[model samples]
Target chain A: MEQDPRDLEKAQAYWRENIRYVAILLAVWFLVSFGAGILFVDVLNGVRIGGFKLGFWFAQQGSMLVFVVLIFIYVWLMNRLDRKYQYDE
Target chain B: MDPWSVQTWTYILVAITFTLYIGIAVWSKARSTRDFYVAGGGVSPWANGMATAADWMSAASFISMAGIISFAGYDGAVYLMGWTGGYVLLALLLAPYLRKFGKFTVPDFIGDRYYSKQARLVAVACALLVSFTYVAGQMRGVGIVFSRFLEVDITSGVLIGMAIVLFYAVLGGMKGITYTQVAQYCVLICAFMIPAIFISIQMTGNPIPQWGFGSTLSDGSGMYLLDKLDGLSQELGFSAYTEGSKSRVDVLAITLALMVGTAGLPHVIIRFFTVKRVRDARKSAGLALLLIAVLYTTAPAVAVFARTNMIETVSNRPYDSMPEWFGKWEATGLIDFTDRNGDGVIQYVQDPERNELRIDRDIMVLANPEIARLPNWLVALVAAGGLAAALSTAAGLLLVISASVSHDLIKKTLRPGISEKGELRAARLSAVVAVAVAGYFGIHPPGFVAAVVALAFGLAAASFFPAIILGIFHKRMNREGAVAGMVAGVATMIFYILKFKFGVFDGGQAAAAGLTGDWWFGISPEGFGAVAMLVNFAVALVVMRFTAPPPAAVQDLVEDIRIPGGAREAGPAPH
Candidate 1:
């Protein structure tokens, strides 16, 4: 069967939301990895939690955990968007 | 340390793992071109996750990364963050879309999206360059482990490893490779974690490695492990463990290059193709990162544990009183002890002239367990684990190289009318040749093996990242724009690497050695990929504006891939 041409607008909206979600998640990605992990590392290292320097923790451990979380969050967000947009497998 | 029984443990474990792998390979051997190419387009997210992790975490990271971290201190975070952070991009930006496109290789996506044979050919070249360079290093890693631990020569070790990897990959194709990789992941992760957990509990009284590195030492000193490490490091005239010697800009650039390059890697990207649905692709990317994080996070902790354990065991100690591991490493020529002060004591201070002990950075992981005096069987397990990591990575890369030759060049470009059975045979034959070439490099590696491997990431970042991103994101991107961008990006990258890494263009070796002052924006060759990627984007955008947009059919193809719902007939995407 042919695609419903009326669904074209829906496709556009889906693409727009996908782009927005990607942009937001990538910003978080940059903030954790490049920002906390690198740029503001020295400033944050001044603060400590338990035995860990905040910046050092972010660089070695915190950023990687955040990265893993970010992907799953994207997956959850995207899957929900697919449902709302009526896109299926 | 033993010549029998426990050393016999290494033999028994290695033999059993290999036999199990062979059994798995034969059981799952590919019967069709589809199975050989994309594993029949059937893989669960969890299983694919393990396979992706195993495919990417090579022996270099398994055996050498912790050692590099021990020496580089905070600067080592470049690798820790750079390597793992790429998954964020892959999962969010690349994997699902690529899976929706539903192709066997990266070049297939590039070729179809851009709708150009030239684009496809350029991609094939880039894929070969990246995969071959990567596989050579993995082959050497396998050889080194066998020679060091199992008392075999490097050639024999590489040949034996090659035969096993070739058996599975050639016969089973991606399907065989995927299942074998999952099993390898299980074996290697257990071997890695067993030692790490033991050492963590011993040192910090914490069972978890991530917590163990940060917690206070259990020695009644009441000081955090990191704080103590910093103090000890400073006492020995080295930089504090929490501080880095690299400029922040250099670190930032290097980390970005690695992250971008990791997303662009063909073998890692292709792992997404084996999964059934777009959502599975996304979920598996997340799962892969979780599995990999288990090692990436523990690596820095292992660095701390090993460095502290090593210094306490060796520094200022009598040479005659050194442990058996030290002597064993010395015989391997990895550790050198000289009495510069004529005191017969090991002086391992950071100061060059006064230092009497020289230890290679690659020895840290292998030696860490021995220094901790863990079980002999545990040490042997590390060797087996290293082999698994190296072999898994090598096999994955070989598949990419083989597919690029057979599917992209032979089947698509040169011989489109070839039958499915003929194409499958071609793929298997190409895999054999690829392994032999990679094996030859392992035995007599080029003098510049390390440099070439480092540049593989840079070249990948420069070329493929832009082409693929623009292909999916910018439907107006035509063949002229994509081809020109790829060429410009790769040329820029090659020029930078040659001038900075090899001193080829203007500065000879002398100038290259001290070329830190000559860096463009203070970025080293290792960090140059980010700059080249920017050049690619700029060139492509400018060229696309001046050139014609792609045909209606290709634009529709782009729209179809972006949506999740159906197969190829998505009408037209609103521009």
Candidate 2:
């Protein structure tokens, strides 16, 4: 009933890789929602895009789009990572 | 029929749909203990995704969120950042491991991981606190929505919501709630989006609400909708729509607190466990986010559009010519107009106290779909959408309350010999009790729904998030450390909140600072979750390092949780 040591190692490696992708995605998340919306508000406000001041857009609309994109990208990367690690059950 | 007649029909339709959902749940009632708790582990990823969407999207999302965004303007980004950012942390750090642990409840995982019954009990207490606070808000929201549309008393409306939730949740358990939530998600999104589309088209000649937000308005103004909003806000002496008034450190801390607090919420975490596989958990999280984003993206647009339109059209309007919505909502006492100067015109502004309007912010968004003059049916759909958001989240939070009581308290502690069937009944009973308690709170309502919700998040962040995270990633966390951390977190947060909220410590309580100065590290009580979470981590780490390590059995359990396909090897251990 024991799991093969190699498979366990492979699973651990897959998890680590998955966590890495998540970390990268999270960095983008912080950038969009927090960095662009709040911290970079002054810098973003100086620039205008379409009808929205950039900072306002980031706060209201832009951060949301980034969040949606983050989720989809996560699914894609996790699926790929799962396949590579042979852990797609 | 007149529009009121149409609105009445819409109410009937929503009622019928809700009833059928519960009927379906009852017909498909869980047959086994596993079926009761985890839906027999057979739910499809997409379906589970829909259910998770229902669970995550609460009354706040449906009613208050858009309003918050509308009135708070740029500061509204806090809710957006906090709620959405939590999903990223959840997907990466929590969901996969929780699924691998293969438990029916959060306390189950905590108990098994720490090899201590006390850890489970502590988790139960936190879960109950968070869920009850959350469910009470939802029940109050449900009452408000129903009483507004159905012409019933708030108490009666709450009773109706309770009946609907209890019937399905008790019959089908998680399985029933899952399918019902899917339908509720569909109802809510359709209800929300249809009006948004109408309003966008009316205001900007744009049908797509999301993109129309940045498009030109009917004024032939070259400025985007957001640009127009900023100009108006400044004109009224309000802060700009996009710029924050809070210190940068405060914003960052609050945003982080909401994200981590959201990630640690037990009801939300339990949703992933219903899916069939680890991959499904990840996939479902994505789908839930997509469903949630549909509303999140449209909400700000609604806020900006509504704010501008209201200021331009209603401000300074003759009292007699006030729109029908004004008259109708006035009757409900939700919207009030007073001519302080006897000028017979309603002046809406933020400055000079004498000129400031006292309109409830909730009105700013709820009245949007109606203000834009969308179809009567679409208006009715908004009513239905609001109910779905409140009821679905209320149901999920109630279930967590039930699970903590039955699994963690009764079965684990008091009566270990109880049969599986007996435990199921206990869970149902627990749910009923939780509903009654929440309903009482709803009728009396301690504070505004938004404020109470913030307090709940603080409790969850301080008490639960660290323990769960440490239990999973760090093997050194012991029962004493976890319990002490939770106690410290909840105690500190409650004491601070009470000092301001109730003025319990009144005379020269300078340290508490009533409301203004009580914010630890500049984070408002609403945003204090981040501070509590950090405190929890520090306490747990400090306590555990000086304490003995958990027994070898606990270490193996931690090791076992990480490896997929090894659950069978661990076998069932007797208590």
Candidate 3:
């Protein structure tokens, strides 16, 4: 168990921040996949970028690219958080 | 076949690649249990990323997904999105935490977290069932590829595949499988991308398939590729290519099920364990998805290109004018054309009775190079790529089976006193048995292999996903809640699968016809996994409220895993 109050607080702060990042990122995940890809697809199909409709693009390709980007962003943010909290070895 | 024929080229490419794989396997044979199970837990993020991508992309993704997409059109997004999106969940929601826990298998984490052997047993059974269902399909895939391309009978193909998998999986274990998978990833990706690029350049002026997917055709028509497809589909009495035919709710449910199921799979989860640190786990998951996206994003373009090319080539063309591929594939029974109107020309329309052409969806990918009239070597590359995909995945699934039996079942539960050397021996023996059984299924596949494969995803989504999530994130979750939840989840999924998919109790094969229209909430049996997973989450939370709180030790372990930094320095949590 952590004896120092500051250490405990820092850990708690780090975890809270991590969860917040997850929530925000997952919302984007939900938006791209479930939102644009499915629910709003018909509506978004009205808009086109060359051969790809906005929704069709999201469904087949856009959402996947975003997913890859989202993970790397999470990694970068979490690594920075660890440094900020002095959790880095 | 002549010496310079496509068949000759396919044989040479297949032989050279197989020898390369066997050589790699021999050089990297495993010596210890850690080496066997997790590649000594020292694989680089890049290599692990490639291996995971290769392992996760089975024969379905490589050989069949594009074909399915070609037939399904807009409805195919469910698979494209479902498979790729799950990696986000894996990286963010699971991987780092699991790595911090730092065990060999998923069962070890679940059993320890819930603090019950019974929970572990539930997990092990689920893993074995899912992995076995999956490996059989892969072996069958290998047989199909060989039969179609190399002119080898399916049984020989399956046996040869079995021998190769057994050699590496039993000898080098995870160490051999991981490195070999990395090489397979290279072969498969190159095989997949080269054809896509060639075809893309042929269709559109753009060389980038992803961009070419959205570009206007090179036929000097300003109409975009997708627009042309949609127009052609409507002209032929099929629905517009960009518009889905399935109900929206069914699409949502299927997508969600596939996404959750991908994350829950034991073989996928174990790949993270091979990497050393928590961050490596997260980074590698990203890399895996990116690599997968290379093939996935290209598929839609290929689908559009092939669908259009096929329609233009033979839609109303005369029987005598039909190309060589027409008769070749027809002999394979994937394509059949009859002169329904007693006219010499073929009628490949949407009206079933008037339609003179019958084409199996799998032919799209198999006949793609021929459709494009590409060179012999590109066709051969596709065969080699298909084999790499099927074998890599089969080897991965076999390892999961062997590990579940030897490490989780025998060492942890049945005989905790077994020596390390003894356990390693058991793992190898289990792998050998697994390869043989998988080969059997490949040769004499059950009639319901496809349905059972769907059930494998459903089972993973229902049972393992909820159990593992609650274990990692919920402090109050106890043995009773987990055990009850897993059992309830799996039972619900099985009941749905049997009732709708197999129709075991209803009317068997006869009821299978009515089953599609009779789905609950209009969600098909394949999509029922999401509903079942929700049921699992509900049952677990409700059960946890009544059960005694977990011990303090379990909570500490959760805390330790939550922080992604220096898991080693934290030391193991007391059980």
Candidate 4:
């Protein structure tokens, strides 16, 4: 049996969309963890959230929450893509 | 008998559970070569996620990470950030595509994609390098956790853990490891959270471990646990509990390096392959993140609770009045209290920086429940949790090593004519050999286990992440490009690490002396993984532009990998 070229192209397209989302998430990941947590910490220290400093939250807790959301979003989005492309399996 | 009963029973119970899991894995072992390496390709998404969690959560996360957080204060979130943040990259960027490609091993994906055996070989080398370093650390962690609880020598502890891990991994192969890891994840999480709940209840009257972190201590001072921790840190000349002093740039770089490194790690990606479908891979990653968050979220709270309790108890106490935990941990060489002022009392102060004692950071997390005079069973539970974390991760890493040697090196390169049974035999043999080597390294670790573990992450970030990312996304990447990128990234990282670790070239006692020579872009060797990854991308792209595209057949193979229908057409045999 021969292989289908279009199937491969579709896969590549899926790959591109996935990568785009990941890259964006990576940027946010960088911003929240390093940006808010460390770089802008002094500025963020002025801003408080529920008795906890905002910057400290990013360093200790906020970044982790973002990561969890990112993964869940990725899974949900990819599942939709998988179905759209008839690659549900 | 009572002291040993809970501790001994926990070990025995965990051992029996692991044995049964391994037995089940063997019974459901993969049938074909693909099955042997990646399961029969029918794992449910949730189960796969559990397996990945088991694989990803190591001794560090299970045991030492909380300890580090307890000691390092807010700065310790680096582990939480780097480890969890990397999964975003994995789920969004890596897992789905790798699943779509549907390869048995990472090297398999690279090899077929690049149309170059050379590319595959380079990947195999990187996988071996990353896996071995990581496995060595896990083995060492297993030994440490066992030694502390079982009252056995570190060497014996390592050997015992190795024997059990080898049984399931070799017998069941990837399928076996996958299932066993799920069990491991359960054991580890339960063990970790149980102790945490008890300690939190004692400290804050809150049963929810995660929320208990922000609660006020029982002293009626109205100060939150973290606030008290910040105060103690200042008194000890340490940075505030919620603040770090390292340059924002360096911390950013290190965190980025860890995230990318986590995504690129071979052992982690391999877990995705165990599931049957591409969608399952995506779901698995999400599930893994959720399971890990259980511990990552609770860890900081544990650290804060432990730190505040330790300070409040020890402050102004005469040296002779120090608690039993001090002596117990000090015997382990993890806790050291030095009275610089000779004041006849343990003076924990944040000012007059020279007046402080340096306690090992790893001691804070695990020893917290014990330090607070929690029950003996809770301490035993912590020991079990630590063992689960170390052993599961170690088993996963050892599988990578064993697979690379038996499947990639021996079968792919050396002798393809070996029968399936013979190959399985070789794979099992390799597993045993890998365990022995890793156990040796763990017992005689090079430096601090946690620091050395960070270097492994750096190495993975530099070498494997780039190659895998490029192989899937860039169709034009050739053998030369992949090889050049991997070599450049890994070599640069190694040179940087050696300079600092062994004092190679110049022993720079002065920070500035080794700054330029050792560091690239002012990022420490521990944080250079990000830099290495960038260098890999640039090198691969440049090299590919100069080189030709992969052959038509390889391109077609990529297309085939993407399409689900052709799997049955190509079938198991390569005609």
Reference contacts preserved by each model: 0.91, 0.66, 0.80, 0.66
Cα error, residue B251 of model 2, in Å, equals 1.8
- Best-to-worst lDDT order: 1, 3, 2, 4
lDDT of 2: 0.79
Question: Candidate 2, residues A3-27: lDDT per residue as tens digits?
Answer: 5898668867865786688779988
Candidate 4: regions farther than 4 A off:
A1-30, B1-32, B339-343, B349-356, B448-452, B507-518, B559-575
Q: Where is model 3 chain B poorest over a 10-residue stretch in terms of lDDT?
A: B566-575
Give the alpha carbon lDDT tens digit for every residue of B385-491 in model 4. 77778878887888788878888788877897887777878888898898888878988886645455666888888878888777665667777888889888888
Writing each residue's lDDT as its tens digit, candidate 1 over A35-63 gives 99999999999999988999999999999
| Model 4: docking quality category | medium
Model 1: residues with Cα > 4 Å off, grouped in runs: A1-3, B1-6, B511-514, B567-575
Per-residue lDDT over B1-575 for candidate 3, one digit per residue giving the tens place of the 0 to 100 score? 56778888888998998888889899998988888998988889999999999999999999899989988888999999999988999998999888888888999988999989988999999999999999999999999888888778899989988988888888889999999999999999999899889999999988999999799999897889899999899999999988969999999999999999999999999999988788888889999999999999998888888899999999888999988888888877878888978999989889998999998887787789889999989998998999999999999999999999999999998998998889999999999999999999999999998789779989999988999889877888998888888888899999988888778886687355765777889998889999989999998999999989999889888877888777551112333
Please tell me the TM-score of chain A for candidate 4: 0.88
Give DockQ for candidates 1 onward, in order: 0.88, 0.60, 0.80, 0.57
Q: Rate the local accuracy (lDDT) of all candidates.
A: 0.90, 0.79, 0.90, 0.75
TM-score of chain B of 2: 0.95
TM-score of each: 0.97, 0.94, 0.97, 0.92
Q: Tens digits of per-residue lDDT for model 1 on B531-555?
A: 9999999999999899889999998
| Residue lDDT tens for model 2, B339-386 | 788888887787666563566676665677667776666777788888
**How would the docking of model 3 be graded?**
medium
Restricted to chain B, the TM-score per model reads 0.97, 0.95, 0.97, 0.92
Off by over 4 Å in 3: A1-6, B569-575
